[model samples]
Target: MATAKLKMSEVRGDVAVGVAQGGATVHALKLEGGKNVPLCPTRPKNGLRHMGLAHEQKPDLELCMKCSAIVPTGPVTVTKEQVSIPGLDRTVIRKVVRPVNDTDTTTEEEEAPVMAENTTTADPRDAQVEEIRASIERLPSLLEADNAEGAEELNGEIETAIAGLGGKGVAALRKTLRAERDKALAAGEEAKAAKTPSAEIVNLETKELDDNGKALIQKGIDKVKELAVNKFQGGHAIAEIVLDIRLGITTKNGYPDISADTDLGKKVGGALIFDDILAGLPEEGEDEASDAIRAEIGSIKKSARNAMQDVKVRYVRSLDNSPEEAKKFGYALEAHPDKKPSEAVFTFHGIQSLTRAEQAKQARELKAAEKEKTRLAIEAGELSEEEAEALSSDGEKSEKEKRTETSNKLKKTALKLISDVKGIEDEEEKDEALEALTVLFADLRKALTAK
Candidate 1:
């Protein structure tokens, strides 16, 4: 007997939407060849759209779903642990952390909290019902407030009446209004407004989501040390992690530079160091295989990114109000025949695609990390402090190891930079550089940790 309704998440990590907890076990599905395929089971139709994910999408699941014949979603749109329901004026009300002690006062230096995936949440219908019931109970006072729109004395009295209820009380009123709106929607009375606020908007301001590096920085710091030490035979993710490592190792010291100067001092200074790409190659090997492979791989990825840059750049119209600009644009109605130009909202789906691609890369990285872990266990007992110090070579001195010497030196350099950055005056600049170095040394340590 199922004690409770089961959700997709409860049944398996792969299913994101439908199932609930305490229901029948989701049977393992297989194909004709016996390979397990990603199966998204049926989910009831829901009107509200979520972020379409509770967390970073899992490799094993289809995060999006299409459902037809959603009659009414019972006012609850549940996506994993999160839920929301419609409110008055097409608003949505849902549970969120209510910060105490003036949250709005945060300074720019204060880093914002990372967004959390829906670990768990109740149905939004619950809020809707609760709101409706509460509003029904307080109808008299609510009616009074509605009646006293411009009466200051009545307004104070009404506010005092609602003050005890807080956000929930306000929500109750919204729910009442939403119910009316939905009823009108079903009756086709207000079809235009029924689409909700989102559908009709030409544009809406949105917070720019943090890039993957920024989002993963702290998590990486905590987990990367262990992850980079891996080695998977077919894994291609080493380049990304290595790319991260290189970034980490690059010191903030102005890169070695050749400066062009007229009669005066150094001007138009440019980096003197060769691109330290392929610098990770184990210096000497009988085969020289990894070198060629890594170089080609790096070059290929670089070319892909470079090729996309021009294609991705979209020009937005320059804001022009000057008299010459007005003349060129044809200020008089008869002068300008062309229609008024619409604003260019340049968007590139590249970031989203790149992220999806990188996810596969990350998987490969993890796989390699596991393999490398096993390899290290055999080659090395453990790196001693003396050996660790010996590897911390810089400039001309650091190059004297076996072909794998550069790998070890990078780690050593990472450690040194992390320690050195503490005394730097600029905290923001130092923090980023430190994280990059941390990622680098951490990756290198994986190679030698076992030996």
Candidate 2:
């Protein structure tokens, strides 16, 4: 005894059904006794039907058997239709629903129509192209501002973006950049070509000399050479010597004495005047001969000074008590009246061995004299006995002091032996002398330690 279910579309006009006032279509029966509700054709799920209602409208309520007293039971028909927009390239799907008589209970779906291909949706490469275009647009302003570094950096970004686009875009901008680069290169070349040649600058301190200055300098050089050969006998440097002689001949005003009537004065005046001229010439234009002469003089003076420093001088006892030793030693003698003839001093220059031997002998003599003086002072009560004992050595001396005294005596004896060996040309006699000196040194060492 179930009631027969029917769809709104399947219902015939002969069926007895309540229709709402003002010709509204009946959607469902109010079984409990209420007004019949009007049907919404757009809401198929509400089991409502209207033939003339717009298909764009949406369903207002959810349809269920519990809310409606009489539910429409029929097959649901779904139709997919393509709706094209006016400006857009692609079409949208419009889903239409229709009520149909249910001969079977299975659900059904309909395929939508194919749409025409268009570019309405966004392309994946569009963003990249926009970024490249923006970079390219910014490049011109950077170039105009003379921001080469900024422009280059921006250009690289633009190029990278364009390269990502497979080099299809930015042709005009690339041509512009190339034209600008060529213009800059041409302008640089033009500027370089138009530049004027500059004159060679001369230093104030070393400017070139004139012809008259050259002749004067050459004459001064000849005079210096002549002076070195005649006066210094080419044995000593001439620069300092010539400088002194020139200064002597010149007056306080730094000019030569040209008014002198004597021949020697005339020669000095000529030489000094030429020297003044040479000194006044610029250093840059100085003749090579003058430079060579100056260098030679400097070398000779340096060598002479070094030789003097290396010369060794020794003081020895005078054998004859005469001043002849002073002349032979190349030093003046110093008078010592209190000393004996054996103790009278003589000097030997440029003799290292003789100098060391004499120095050792003098040191030993001084020590002995001091000891004797200390003993005498104690006897006269001028010095305390304890002080005299301190001055004199004990029976056992310090090992260091004894060794030093022994070494000095040995050095003196060895120096004497070397001197004698040098005098003897025979090799065998020299060897014999050396052996004898060695034996004497051994004996001396023993005697010193015994004391």
- Candidate 2 lDDT over 256-305, as tens digits, reads 32222344444543445445555655564367776665445444544433
- What is the C-alpha lDDT profile of model 1 across 1-451, one tens digit per residue? 3133232232322122321111111222212121112132322121111212222223343222211111111111233222333343344433333112245476523523212212233323334345444543343343334433433343343333333222223556644654543343333323433444674364664445468757788787868765543322112343333222332232234211111112111111111111344455566464479666664654444443333322222111221323343332232322333423112112111122233345578877876775566456545866544454344322133323554677688668857766788868643334445655566567767987867
Candidate 2 lDDT (Cα, 0 to 1): 0.43
Error of 1 at 320 (Å): 88
Question: What TM-score does prediction 2 earn?
Answer: 0.15
Runs with alpha carbons beyond 4 Å of true place in candidate 1: 1-94, 97-416, 447-451
Q: Model 1 reaches what TM-score against the true structure?
A: 0.15
Alpha-carbon error at 108 in model 2, in Å? 62
Angstrom error of the Cα, residue 49, model 2: value is: 76
